[model samples]
Target: MPISDVSSLLPLLVAIPLTGAIFSVLINSKHGQVLTGLLAALSLALVICAILLGLPSEGLQSTTAFRYPLAGWEAPLGIALSLDGFSALLLTLTTFLVTVLTFYSAYYFSASPARVRFWPLWWLLVAGINALFLSADVFNVYVTLEIIGLAAVALVALSGNKAGLTAALRYLLVGLLGSLCYLMAVALLYHLYGTLDFAQLAAKAESNPLSWAALALITVGLVLKTALVPLHFWLPHAHGSAPAPVSAILSALVVKASFYLLVRFWMEILAPAVTNDALMLLGILGGLAILWGGIQALRATRLKLMVAYSTVAQIGYLFLLFPLLMSAEGTSASQLAAQHQSALAAVCYFIVAHACAKAAMFIAAGNIIHSLGHDDIAKLQGMAKYMPLSLFTFAIAGGSLIGLPPSAGFIAKWLLLNVAIDTGQWWWVVIILTGGLLAALAIFRVLDLAFIKPEQASEQVAPDNWQKVPVAMPLSGLALALCTMALGFNADLIIDLITIGGGE
Candidate 1:
């Protein structure tokens, strides 16, 4: 489905929330917060409705766009909001997760004195992220990315603690620098191609030295922002210190946004031959991060920090797709073998799977934090009695992360394994399994500690029920995680849409 209708409302889907943010901030009161939350929910609900109504009959691919002129002009000079299968998938995730996160935050921050402040900034961030997903031009993407980054920092600092404040500042500096590098790369692309539109640039980019430099800078900038290995120094600290809802959004979507940009810029705009080395570089670092992060997570004493480091490990799996996509045998080639790049499917599948599962894990962790008043893994003995939802949710999500059977993660891993074998490159398989095993070690460490019954009476402060975060919230994420696995059984559905018009 190509975008034939400029009145499809994709731009409005993003704009409504941005406007709602200003409306909410202007009326900052208890009534205002409640009203804003309701408005935010309604706007997102409507966007999802629009998506549902427009979901392609074809199943796997869908797209919609609004070629709105900024004051009345043509597309080459103006801008447009285009939603392809990939962008639509991202949009659905953003809206679904925002709705859940908003609901969870209602209770997660209920006891806090500053609920009003959270809603405005949080909604604004969601708007920026949605806008990022919708933008078709490089400059628009950069602008939306800037807004998302600033609002994210504000959300992080809302905790008002030393750790949160410090992490926010550090994340800001690194984030801005990365943004700078990406902006420069985009500028170079514009100068070279005379176009900022992704589609236009894709056709124009050549495997020349100047284009190659732009590709390298863009790839490096996005990888840094995505927090792949060595460049991920700020993520664990920021994620560990933020409130649970914030952590969920950060891990599930925010960091992934950078990765999405990498996909858009590298796999779409730039010629494949221009950046194979960088992709391999990313994959190598991703493999290392998988093992290193999992082991560090296993050693962490605090639950939130443990979860944060777990993020570090899970992120590594995403990068594994790079090398597979970039080469025939970890070496660059002008032409790629179609049979060798099954890793693209694996990457898309894993991202969808991880988004749902990680969101659940973070919300569940919040439930534990709220109910138990602490996140120390050592202190959580017999927590199943009080935090069953949290424990079980973590387990289910962890199962997915570990590539266990009947889970989406497993489906994704199997595909990547097939790709490696098909290409006669089995070392990547070794890295994948090692990562999965280490993830298992980290997961069981927490579970074993949590399952241990204690002698002393660690009084449970929360009442038995309503004790965990809202049932609907975590359940939504869990349901999505299940859908991710269901994708395997329904492979025909996604395959049909993966290459729909403009899904390149």
Candidate 2:
């Protein structure tokens, strides 16, 4: 495919899923699932095509950034969807995950009537995520963010239990508050610069009081949505009480959407207004989140909640990039630029690694809960005997979470450690190592119980009491987990794709 052909298909990434969402509402429940799955697969193909066609023929030079103006109108007056290497990488990640989860969800909600509602909302959430990645303007981002939050809330409520309903309500309220804050920032920027386009805002933005205010507002809003420490009170319950596939999507992709926006604002559009003090503050919160989330995970008695809290810890790793980038302030111009690129690349790797690892973990947890009728950690003794695949899936995914060697998580953390060391911020290195140790403890806590022999187990359940889980559930999870390991071996390809469009 030619670059132009691939660029023309960019809008379809959003359109196909959005159309599927609408059509799902008008179709039969079973057919809706089929349609949603097919559309998600198509979206994934589009993303793959974009990456292959947009890659330069030789070297590390970036391909041209493609922009598709809606209705022949460009930004400032009309919305434009963009397909640069950054957005392309995220789109590929988003579509790939959604495709796999769509299959997992088909079997997950197969017996439940909620499948009727799940398919539409699932596609809606996918549409929103893709749109947010491609959005060239702040206002469009806010619009897509709202779409994603609302769809996710609806999906969460589909669980139909009191706990699920309560968590969904809390999620809705928190999402609205975050959206309001982000909208305020959008309005402020538009008023000051008379434009909502990111490129325009970046060019026109000044290091002034209003810009700083907008920065603060954007940061708080995105941080709240991303479920960073201190403001992350709503994430655990919402992720834990939701259905397994919903839990997987929330941990793997939903939080990343908001974080992606925060990165764009902090590192690109608002770069001139960003201060070392602010970056350090973000790093401080990230470090605290790693410790606090890890402690919470260790304390969690339920398997799902442990994975949910672990998400909080994994999210903390991404924020460390901000402070590490700040540490390059005194370097030579070439060195500073190189450090910036490396830092961005590291965060990108972390995001993809976490998405795959965390999604696999949640699906594995879901499979265990599906088979055993509950996710109580203490009662999971001899899980290896009854549900070896699910337990193994969880352990393998957990290994990635713990940054074990030859896993994607190890590569991400290694890159981050190098950046910290190169920038002379050895303190972050300590935090990184400590967080990994804490993660290992939390992960192994489950493994030790699951792997115990039935005869030697402390809280063994009867073999006859276990229910049969669908074969697809554990297999899907294993596939995602293996993808994480595979990523560890192919960092160069991902890095090449990410560095496209000038590594922005």
Q: In candidate 2, what are the lDDT values of residues 58-150, reduced to their tens digit?
A: 523433357778888987889888766677788888878888888888888888898888888988998899899989899999999999999
What's the lDDT for all of these models?
0.75, 0.87
TM-score of every candidate: 0.90, 0.97
Tens-digit lDDT track of model 1 for 400-450: 888898887888888888887776668889988998888888888777766
The backbone clash count of each candidate, in order, is 2, 0
Pairs of colliding residues, candidate 1: 60-497, 61-497
RMSD of 1: 3.4
Candidate 2 segments whose C-alpha is farther than 4 A from its true place: 57-64, 327-329, 456-459
User: Pairs clashing in candidate 2?
Assistant: none
Q: Which portions of model 1 show Cα errors greater than 4 Å?
A: 1-3, 59-72, 272-275, 327-341, 452-495, 502-504
Model 1 is weakest, by summed lDDT over 10 consecutive residues, at 59-68
